[model samples]
Target: MPFSVYALGLAVFAQGTSEFMLSGLLSGIAADLHVSVPAAALLTSAFAVGMVIGAPLMALLGRNWPRRRALLFFLCVFAAVHVVGALTSSYGVLLVTRVVGALANAGFWAVALVTAVALAGPEARARATSVVVGGVTVACVAGVPAGAWLGGQWGWRAAFWAVALVSLPAIAVIAATIPAGRSGAALPSARAELRTLAGPRLLLTLLTSALVQGATFCAFSYFEPIARHITGLGSAWVPALLALFGTGSFIGVTVCGRIIDRRPVAVTAAGLVALTAGWVLFASAAGSAVAVVALVLVQGMLAFGTGTALISHVFRLADGAPTLAGSFATAAFNVGGALGPWLGGLAIGAGSGFRSPLWVSAALMVVALGTAGAAWTRRSAPALRSDVHAYEQGSSDG
Candidate 1:
């Protein structure tokens, strides 16, 4: 992989830390802002809402600009918003900042994924994506835990400030390494991009992405509560468990990247199945501390490992519009992000234990598994194979 790919990962790490860090900080935030824990948890949903809106809007806004420039601009905005979030004591202002920060974060992801694949070319597309998305896994391992620890000691505001500070070096690295005008394709007209994105295959793939992500977040968004109430772990142990989950994710993504190009459908289906099993196991064994930890690790691996194949599958189905396809994928993921947490909150409020979300997650993954199985059956069609071949050829030629 190119050094620039790692630079993109660094940017992702900074943004992802901000994104996932909230899961651990929800209690502190609720108390500090004079809100209920579930209400404070809405901040996660608010960020996802911003991502769902921002992906296309930011793509359109930056359509004419170089990918590098757009990335830099977005990262700066992301950092600034984190600073705003850190300084604000008002809950309303903090909520607004999460949305704005997520807008910036969404733009960065859209551009970063496209740029990573472009740099690596067709042959290494999945690996390139894994390398970039690895930043998020690393954040789960290191950054999120650090933020949680910081919040535990200083306050949730300190966590936001830490993210803001982290973004500076990421910005500097991206500026110094990523070359201008060297990544991404020429911007197509809005009409053309929309038409490409509207294809049935791409749409189905996007739906699969949404379902899979929703399943993961349904349980994951409330992991802290699950740890406390279900596993009987203290607050200090939550970050370490999260790190174990992240480690599993790191391993999953790495393995998926190596084989996804050869067996995209099979790999995705297997991941979904594993994810379903993980959730089922977690739900069944919620009372056992060891079982809960093991199941979380398994869930994290399957959930995140499937992401590379899903995105790569979308890129293949996209025909000629990878950037827009990427934006749509990002939007779909966030749509899941927003819905999962909201639904989980409802379940919890309705007196469903924290384990309820795991069952819910398992059910959602079953749906995603069906979606993946359907796509697999279509994979052998002559027309689809031809299109895939053409896409591969075009990518290589470019």
Candidate 2:
């Protein structure tokens, strides 16, 4: 169980690095490809858009396959996409490759969640799930910064190459460590997963995910410029600052499982509140380097801390369709990813300083907090399919 969790986490880390690496190397990519920063930003947006479209679609396609085979297939395609991305010289070709890679990434995550939960056998589901998915947090802390540095020193293409190399090994690890089995329950039909997305509870969860994640990425997309304007940091220092924030995210991911298991609603509400405060502080105290870095660390933790909780929240809400619920949540995340930075960029274009985006982001988190509080006020939130007694009774057996 531990090995499978770690293997999936590593695969997710590699994918996460691939997704965010472009942000760190945006300037280099723009210059090398003879395009504007905004044009290069489109590449980032394209990846998110692909995930938004691919999450449910790919999940449906693999609805009947054994989870291990589904994962292997996706990782193989993911690796190939990176290889193509690294080798492509034409910006147009690279853009297509990135979109393809993002689709594979979405599929990998959707399938991996089910596989992780099944492998844990419901007893340690929360912790096992967290460990497997913590790869994204690790990427935020370590992989993204490493990719950024490699891009800065070697070239943007080199970062993609690094991701591909890591993914190859991750594929091998997952194949070796995870036993052969169909990870998700066999659906009567592919459309069955859609039921999870249609309910009020699931809808609310999706809305919260979109708003919270959108706010986060809105500010995150412009981190480098924000750091430069506020902290007077050079480009050379940006990656290190990113790494510091990532460290905080790592801590958040490690602790989130316990927090969620104890009280899902309270933890989520608290996380959003913290996220709001972090953004507000970032916008206000951004002029001071010390203050900015402090807020950056806080922002990383508060923003990312809700990730696993949110996933668990979805599963609880759907009670009937865990795999579908998980995939839908991922789709919501992609929706936020696609929209957040674009909104921030719009604000930036409107002559609002980089800090302006933080205001918009903070406001969004405030709204999310309100929604989460309302939905999760009771100890027996509707999202939780089973009560404490039921969960406890079943734990020993599972």
Candidate 3:
């Protein structure tokens, strides 16, 4: 709620922009570097893999530092990597830059998130966290499209340069606004929280989260190529399409926020089923530009809707440990982020064509749907039965 909280969100915006901007730039980067599109796509995976590995590791390594200091440190490193990435001609060096940038972004996220919550105080934790998350959504809606457009005009390296430029201002904001102190309250050590993840219900929640992300990104990571090769769109349309996808995501999260708490399991199940259906239809429809365009919005909506509900469920399951919840959610989603692009890349590399990624997306959703069903039958059935029994007894007394 405070200016400091918003400043933290600004930092998050810079990191998220870099995280997602690569999808739009993949084609250009590939052609320029003389690599296949699939190979270039691995940059997304590289960044995600780094995030998966970096969040907790960076958090631990900087556990003693002031939150503001850590935030500046990470942002500076993030900016530096982008500069290196932009300057490099070699695909391999660029790939390494993506990984390094992600590590820095992951560390900044780990530190900044708790700092925002700490700044907002205990009762407003979720709201504060949402401010940070809202930054990512805005990055999707605004930053990604702008990055794509910039990449289209000046070159892909321009997008990387743009991220570095934005991060500098963000760094300044964080330095000016965030209070210098211990990043967050000392709570249960991450070691103690490991036991919480062992629970079947929590694992199912995380699995659903991972699968849904993987499914969406399988197609999404290649949206540019899909537009170019499959839909027959020019480079100009790619940025607009990416914008539409991002708009759908913003709307999906907003829609889910209204209803997830009341029917979390049901919403997740329905979203997974719809997303699966959407992907299958998309595979069949890829030749039709109109169909492909329309389905992008539908697919985006369903994917984020399911994903939003799953994250809420994750927090609910890990309520007692904020640090654990944050790190676990980051790791789970990025696992999907990393895996989705890599798997999709493999499909493309195998000469499966662009449609293959759509099939891959659908397959992942099928697995997610199964996981949702297992959670419902295995975890919710007992609770449902008890509620039914109480209702029956009350009726009999009446």
Candidate 4:
């Protein structure tokens, strides 16, 4: 809850904008670069790929570096790339910038998550994570839209310039706030951290993280079409709906932070189930304006709330591998982010209607929920049996 922790959120906000802002500029970028729209869209994919690969790699590579130094390093790298991207006329150069920017962003999150926990303490890890994730939701609500508007007004390159400019202040804030120590969280050796990957508990937690994000993006990716086809909303309403979803998500992340550490499994499982039901309701109540609006808001809340909880679970589950934890969690998310939209695209392309992605989202959430439930049951079973045996023995004596 320190001001410094919030400063870390500022860093995340800057990097996150770079990740989500491209969608609004894709067409303009395609036209500017004389590439197909589909080709232009590959920049997004390139960013994701960098994020996935960069998280663990950068985290490990900088495992020994000072936390403050590591954070600033990533931020500076991210900002520099955006500047390069903004100046580059060649599509190929811009493509490389996206990957480099994402790599830097991933490193920042890996270090930031650990730093947030160190700054806030382990007891408030979830709360610290909420602060971190709250940045992304704010990016969704504000950054993406602003980037789109900027792109429309000036050009796609201007959005890139804006991102680079926005990131500069984050560098100053993060450097001023974060500890100068060589690393806040002391990491185990690389061998031991890698061994942690073999743990079932961590693997399950990672899976939950992926599914949570996958489910979220699956439905979110097609929100524009869903609004148009299902609720028959005009183009004007789409941004409002997305913003509403972001607002709900911001609220949910805050709420989840308060209780996730206390009731991680119960809250996450319940949330995923609720999200699944919300998707079903969305699919079924397509014609109802109120239902569509309500479901979108609630779905956003459940998705982000559960996501924060799951990542918190990952940090806990991978506690022994502190150096690797955040990176793995980050990787799980990018993996999910990439997969979800692909699935949604497939669903829509197959002519299953706009709601097909809703079903896909529901199914993925159900799986995530089931994974958490089953793991809890499995862990609880032995304790339950031991209690029963003791109770039966006492009864016989009585």
Specify the highest-lDDT model's number.
4
Off by over 4 Å in 2: 27-37, 183-188, 231-236, 377-398
Question: If both were scored by TM-score, which would come out higher, candidate 2 or candidate 4?
Answer: 4
Clashes of 4: 1
For model 1 the local lDDT of residue 186 reads 60
Candidates by lDDT, descending order? 4, 1, 3, 2
Pull out the clashing pairs in model 2: 141-246
Clashing pairs in 3: none
In candidate 2, position 175 carries an lDDT of: 83
Better of 1 and 4 by lDDT: 4
* Clash-forming residue pairs, model 1: none
* lDDT over C-alpha atoms for residue 378 of model 2: 44
lDDT of the structure predicted as candidate 1: 0.84
TM agreement with the true structure for every prediction:
0.88, 0.88, 0.79, 0.95
**Candidate 3 C-alpha lDDT tens digits along 1-398:** 68887777777787889988887788899999999999998898788889999987887766667878888898898999999999999999999999888888888777776676667765555456556666776798899878988999999999989888987777787788777776445766666666776678888878988988898778887888888998898988876787788778766766776666666667767787788899999988888889978988877777776776777676767755555565667678788887887799899999999778888988988898888778767687788999999999999999
Local accuracy by lDDT, each model: 0.84, 0.79, 0.80, 0.87
Q: Write the per-residue lDDT of candidate 2 for residues 1-398, one digit (tens) a residue.
A: 57777888889999988888787799988898898998998898788888888888788778677778889999999999889888877899889988888888888888888777767766566676677667887988788878988988999989988999999888888888777775344465445557656866667778888888889788877888888886688887776777877877777767887567777777877787778888888888777888877877777777777766787777666666755665787888778877788889899899987888888898888888777766555434644656666888899779
Tell me how many clashing residue pairs each candidate has.
0, 1, 0, 1
Q: What is candidate 2's local distance difference test score?
A: 0.79
List ranges where model 1 is wrong by over 4 Å.
Answer: 26-40, 182-185, 231-236, 382-398
- TM-score for predicted model 2 compared with the true structure: 0.88
